[model samples]
Target: MGGQPPAEPASEEYTVDQLAAKVGMTVRNVRAYAGRGLIPPPRLVGRTGYYGPDHVARLTLVRELLGKGYTLSAVERMMSELPDGALALGVFETLVSPWTPAEPEVITEQQLADRAGIPHDPATIAKLIELGIAERVDDGRLRIPNPDLLRTGLEVIKLGVPLDAIFEMLPKLFEQADQVAKIYVELFRNTVWRQFADAGLPAEGWPEIQRTLENIIPLAGQALVAAFRESMGREIETAAYEELGLPPDEFSSTG
Candidate 1:
C-alpha cells in the first residue's frame, strides 16, 4: 500500500490593489511604503507580486502609527527596533480599543426618531450628532456608534426625564467621565507603563502588558460603577431627608 500525500496548507494571498483596499489605503501609498522598505517585499511569480498576512499586518501597523502622529522616520525607526511588530500592534490595538465594544447601527431618520422617542426633525438629529449619540453618514442616514448608550438614554427619557434636561446633563457627564478616564490612564502611565518603559519595552513583556491591560479594563469599570452607585445613594437619601423636613437620623426612628 502507498502512503497518501499531505494536503497543502491554505493561505490568504492578495494582489497589490486588493491589499490596498483591505487596509483602506491607496495603491500608491502601498507602493511607496514598499519602495521605502517599510514593509517586506512581496512574493513574486514572473512579473506579478502577491502579498500575504505579514504584508497586511505591516501595512496596517504603518498606517496606525502614522495616524497616531508618528513621523515616517520615527515609524521606520520603531518598526526596525521591534522583534515582532505584529505582536506589538496587537497589544497597541487592545490598549486603545474600547473596553466594551459595540456594533454601530445605521438607521433612517424616521427610525432614529421612533427608537429614541424624539421628534424626527433636523434640530433633533443635529443634537444627537452633537451629543455623539449618532453620526450622519455619506448617504444622509444616521449611524449610532453606541446603540447601548442610546438605549440607556431612551430609558432615562421614559422615566419622565425631559430630553432637554438629559441633553443639558450630557456635557457635564462626559467631562466627569473624561476625568475618571484620565485618572486611570495616569495611574497606568506612572506605574505599569513607566516600569515597562524603564525596562526598555522588551519583546517578551508584551504578553504580560496586554494581560495587565485586559484585567484593568473590567476592574476600572467595576470600580467606577460601584463608586457611582454609592455616591448616588448618598445624594438621593440626603435629598429625600431634606424634602421630608427631617434630620438624616430621623428616618430610622420613623420607620
Candidate 2:
C-alpha cells in the first residue's frame, strides 16, 4: 500500500518494434527514451510490453526537439509544460501527410540520352535547363526533375519541333494549368473545406478532407485530358477536311 501504484495498461497499442518502426526510430532508441522518461512507459501484459499513440506522439516530439539541438533533459521539461495531445497533431501528422515531391534523379548526359533514346546536344541541354526541365549541378551531372516529362519533350524535339519553340510554349501552358488549379481549389474552398471551417474544424474530419483531395486528383487529370483530346480531335478533323477541299461543316457532322 505504501509502495508506488501499478501502471495502467493501454488497450489499443503497438509492440515495441512496431512503435519504433512507426516513429522512424530504432528499438534501442525507443527503449532508451522510455527509460529516460522522455516517452511514457509501455503497457505490460504477461511480460510483454506495448506502446500506444501517446508514446508515438511523444517520440515524434522528442526527435523533433533533439534535431533542433535541445538536450534530452531540456526536451523533457518542454514536453512536460504542454498539455496532453498538444504536440501530437502536427501540421503534417495526419492520416495522409503532405505530398512529398519526388527527388530529382542525378544522371550524366550520356545516361539521359540513353534513357530517352535521343541524341545528346549541348544546346538542347541548355534549352532544357532554361525551360526548368533539367538542372546542371556543379559536379557536371544533370538533375532531371521528371524523366517522363523530359522524354515527352525529347520526342517533340525529334519530331522537328525546335527546343526554343517548346521552351516558349511552357510558360503559357503552365500559366493555364495554374489557373485551372486555382479554379479547382476555389471550388473546394467554397464547398468541402468551407463546411469543415463552419463545423469548427474538428480533428476527426481531417481524414475526410484528405480523402476528398485524393479523389479530386484523378478527377482533375481525367477532366483535363478529356477536354484536350476533344479539342484536338475537332481541330484535326477540320484541318483534314480543309486539306481535301471540303467544307468544315461536312466533316463536322460526320465526326
Candidate 3:
C-alpha cells in the first residue's frame, strides 16, 4: 500500500523511487550503492529509504562529473577532499544545494530501452543506478535521481563512447573542471565585480549577466569541441582513415 504523504512537499522529498525515475536506475541498485558508501545513505522512513531532493541534486552532479570524465574512485576521492571534518561537510551541503539545475520530462526505463535499443536488465539498470541516473524504489517504480542530468546523459551516450571508457576518463575531466571553476570564481571577484565595481550592476546588469552565463557555457563547449575536431582533421583527411581501414564517410566534414 502507498505510505503517508512526505513531511514536506512531495516534489521536495523525492522518495527513492521518484529519484530513481528521474535518473534512470532501479531501487535495488540505489540501495546497493548506499551500501557501497558511494553516497550519503538516505534516511529510512517506515519500510522505505527516503531520499530527499538533495540526494537527487548531488546524484545529478555526480553524473555530470562522470560524463565529463571522473571515475567513481576519483569522484569519491574528490568528495572526500571537500573540507576536512564536519564543518566542511556542512559547507558542502550548502554549496551543492542551490546551484543544481532542473529539467522537464521524466525519462523512464521503457524510453531508454527504446532509444538505445537495449533491454532493461538488472545489470544495465544497476550500472545506471550507481552512476546516479536511475533509482528503483521500494514501491516498484523506477525514477530519475536528477532530472537535469537525464538529457545530458542521453546525448553523451549517443557519442559512441562506451560508458566504461567514459568512466575511465572521468577523473581527468573533473580535475580540469575544478580548475576552471576556481578561475571563474577569481574572475568574478577581480574583473566582473571589481572592474565594474562602481557600475552597481548586480541589479541593473544581473539580468544581462545571467543571460550571458546561460549563453556562454554551451557556446564555449561547442567551440572547444570544434577546435579539437579540427586539430585532428588534417590527419583524418590525409591517411588516418585509410590506415585504420575505416570508411571515408565516417570522417566526412562539411568544412
Winner by TM-score:
1
Displacement of the residue 137 alpha carbon in candidate 3, Å: 4.3
Tell me how candidate 3 scores on lDDT: 0.60
Indicate whether candidate 2 or candidate 3 has the larger TM-score.
2
- For model 3, the stretches where C-alpha displacement exceeds 4 angstroms are 1-111, 136-138, 145-163, 169-185, 196-255
Q: Write the per-residue lDDT of candidate 3 for residues 1-255, one digit (tens) a residue.
A: 466664444445667788778766676756665665655776766566677655665565556556658887886775544322233333334344344556333556777666655566666667767765677766655677566565565567687777677655656665776776676557556765465445743334544444545554466557667866986777666576788777778866546
Q: Write down the RMSD of candidate 2 (Cα, Å).
A: 7.6
Error of 1 at 246 (Å): 1.5
Q: Give a tens-digit lDDT track for model 2, residues 65-160.
A: 787588988977766544343333352243223333365688998887766566787887787788788999999999988776777777887787
Per-residue lDDT over 223-255 for candidate 1, one digit per residue giving the tens place of the 0 to 100 score: 999999988888888888999998988875322
Candidate with better lDDT, 2 vs 3: 2
Candidate 2: stretches off by over 4 Å = 5-103, 114-119, 241-245, 252-254
**Residue pairs with clashing backbones, model 1:** none
What TM-score, computed on C-alpha atoms, does each candidate reach? 0.77, 0.62, 0.39
Candidate 2 — worst ten consecutive residues by lDDT sum?
91-100
Task: Return the top candidate by lDDT.
Answer: 1
Q: Find the 10 residues in a row with the least total lDDT in model 3.
A: 82-91
Provide the lDDT at 115 for model 1. 70
